[model samples]
Target: MKLRPLLITASRWKQIQQPLYPWVVTVDRIMRHERLGNMPGPLVHLFSDYGGAHKESLYETTAVLYMDVDNSMPWQVERLRVRQHFLPDGRRMSFKGLNDVKKQQALIPFLQASDSIPGVLLVAAVHKSIKNLCWSKDVRPDWPSDRAMRHKWSPRTFERALHVSHLAGLMVGGLSNPGQEVFWFSDEDELFANPTASNDVGNLFTMFTSVYANHPFKQIGLGTTAIDEGDRYEEDHVALADLAAGSAADMLTELAKYAGHIPTKVAIEFPGEFSRKTEIITSWLGYSGGNLKKVMVVLEPQGKTGFSVMRLNW
Candidate 1:
């Protein structure tokens, strides 16, 4: 994919800022020929995954994949077939598992064929140094002391929940139809490991949707499941987001070294060492000509207090 400067519309950008992350950017792309409004009872399924949250990384990335339930079966079948082709013994396909050129090559055909399934991959990458600058002061500052005491969370968990909720709000605001049901499935993560934290996040997401997104839906469901225990097909969708998040995080980390000052509209060039993983990631980012639309919104810090949002294109 290519990189360019992006200008987000003011209204949409305002809604996306509800998380109050200080540095947030939203990028959206629709590749399907049919208009979203024309679709019948459009049920949205969102699968999310995150990467680069470790202390050593400069950027943390979150990826969310949105798909309509109407195309779920066919997409699931195609994914299963692809998995079987590569792993006859019935193993799972994961970003980490694609360790060699051969396995990475196996992904191209499936990704190419996935064009029939209308989907959108949305990614948000934030600079870790500023991620928690004014956490308590900015986010829900007026929360009752009692409620705050009851629903205590570490800053890290709060940040993770905030990302997921904000992404869900954006998805609903941009994609959902009236009376349509929306479901969210995420790969097991520490944010959801505790039942209380998970429930709190779910409640926060519902509130965010109703207040910020302003989209009416029949119902909203959230599920956090282990990859092995969850439906294989759904897990595959999460895996796709996982790969994207990892790739975006790695790309940003590498870009930061040479990008003394982030430019406006420049092609992405990693002059450093490129491993097999990087090769696969670059290829995936370059993919086009399908119903699977991809958008990457990079929120780079400008000064100590502000940031810039740019959309990367293919």
Candidate 2:
């Protein structure tokens, strides 16, 4: 994409030197390499979903998928075909909902088809141990004392911040176009429990990119929808991100058990027998080509106060 790189100011550069620095660098590299020379349409659509919030897992994941299509009809048509073949009863497709091995295998070809959809999938997996660190004050210094104190005690608050930060990071790194508008759709969660919270999230996103990325969208719009009541077109995109996030969490959780120690970087390999969900995601990632690209980054604790970022390769 003939996009301009974000101009990080001296002050922003200081913040970038924090724990999330490695992740930002990784994202920039992936975006520049994969999206170079690809012109985006007038509008860019970003669909997002998150997973691995439970305390049992070692990481929480946020997945964002962006496409530069002026017309979404092609994507909708393929979504309908996949739904008719796999779920004709109006049931929604989800990562956790795919149970039967044969059905998962059957769905692989459709997901792997080059004509299915055109977009780039970005997944951010953050270690749960990050909650113990006190870096939010540096990340968002404008927060009032009461809010900052709450974040210090509330894991959910910390998670919401991480989610927004990663979303903003991906947008600045991957989807930077001068006059191109952005429409972001996210699955309903505690992050957007009410209209006021939703607006706050939107404002935070805009402010984040403006201050840290030194790039802001011409017009940024945000929407939230429940999984059961959402429009099919929106749901399909969100479901793709949901699958990716959940699959990454599953694989990383298993990998954590096997690694036992944090290495500087570790290439991702399925260390054990794959579940139906992992198998489907693995097949999809392995076969992704032609206008569709996928990248996964994991941020794990490096020391008492630092983090290491590693790109996960299939």
Candidate 3:
């Protein structure tokens, strides 16, 4: 993956030091789970192809769900492929590779099965209208370096969404385990080449380090980090993460229906065809206030806003 690097001159760094946004409204209690343990598997991976973008196109909202599973065999349902379908009414999604329904079927059962696996946690983060975000710009006036990197791969929308998704994953891992080591998606060759300045892997390491320096939330410790190349089909943990994210995306679409807006304008709206599946998924994740509990917390500019988080019992 060829990526443009963020080369910052000394003067540019000085400009970025100025506070663009003075105060931020952040969610206090995000990673609700307290009993986090050190395990060896993919720390956090995202899935966003589930067609859950927000309305108006001012900002596209994407939900990323990460899970850490105990070292074990992959889930039996890893082979299931949830394909997208189109019709006159709207869009429909279902599990392919088997003809149990031959039509659109509820994916909640698969989602529930994935969540039921032992030693698994489902942490969610939603990026809204990622393009409008301040951090999405590839070249800012403050940091006037043409070669400066913009998020991960694609620029504009994709870069912003990736940044938020990554932050969500990091917030979950950093807050949960404190000094726990996280495995980012990367390859050995790329890691060896850049180590600390690579696009996704190395940049993620640096972000984790920076967060550790100015730690917030609850947990405390000097966090550790690493990287990996996530293959959805072969890797069990990656597959699970994908399913979790996809599940959350589906749920978000369902929630939008009640809000008078449906994501992707899918013909088969949530609970429209899979009411039973919707019920099961809702019960598992539960509701945070009246919302579906997909997003725990959000940080944004003063005027602009994001998701809300539930109050922490702690």
Collision pairs in model 2: 1-35, 1-36, 1-37, 1-38
| Each prediction's whole-model lDDT (CA) | 0.66, 0.62, 0.34
How would you encode candidate 3's per-residue C-alpha lDDT over 1-314 as one tens digit per residue? Answer: 01112232221000111222221112212232323333334333332222233452222333333334333234433323322221222223331212335323535444444543324233333445333444534424554353354333434444443344344444443433434344333212222234233454344434433443333333212111122222223233333333334444555444544544322212332335334443444455442331112332222122355333221110
- Residues 160-256, candidate 1: write the lDDT tens digits: 7877777776677666667888888888877677777778778767765775565468889888645345346666777788888887777777767
Q: How many steric clashes does model 3 contain?
A: 8
Candidate 1 worst ten-residue window by lDDT: 30-39
TM-score of each: 0.82, 0.78, 0.46
How would you order the candidates by lDDT, starting with the best? 1, 2, 3
* TM-score of decoy 2: 0.78
Candidate 1 wrongly placed segments (more than 4 Å): 5-41, 100-105, 133-136, 143-151, 227-231, 265-269
The collision pairs in model 3 are 6-149, 59-129, 60-129, 90-267, 91-266, 91-267, 184-228, 186-228
Evaluate model 1: give its TM-score. Answer: 0.82
Model 3, runs deviating above 4 Å: 1-25, 32-131, 134-147, 150-154, 161-165, 172-181, 186-201, 213-234, 261-314
> Per-residue CA lDDT of candidate 2, range 1-314, in tens?
01122333221111232224335665555444443324357787778888787776788888887777675456667667776776665565578777755446445644654234556777888888776332465555645453322212245665465565456545544455667787778888766766666666676566555544445567877786553363466777777888888887877777777776334543444347667677668567655455567767678788798786665665
Runs of candidate 2 exceeding 4 Å displacement: 1-23, 35-39, 71-73, 100-106, 113-116, 132-135, 140-155, 212-218, 226-231, 265-271
Q: Once model 2 is optimally superposed onto the true structure by TM-score, how far is the C-alpha of residue 175 displaced, in angstroms? A: 1.9
* CA RMSD of all predictions: 4.2, 6.3, 12.9
- Backbone clash numbers for all candidates listed: 0, 4, 8
Please give the lDDT score for candidate 2. Answer: 0.62
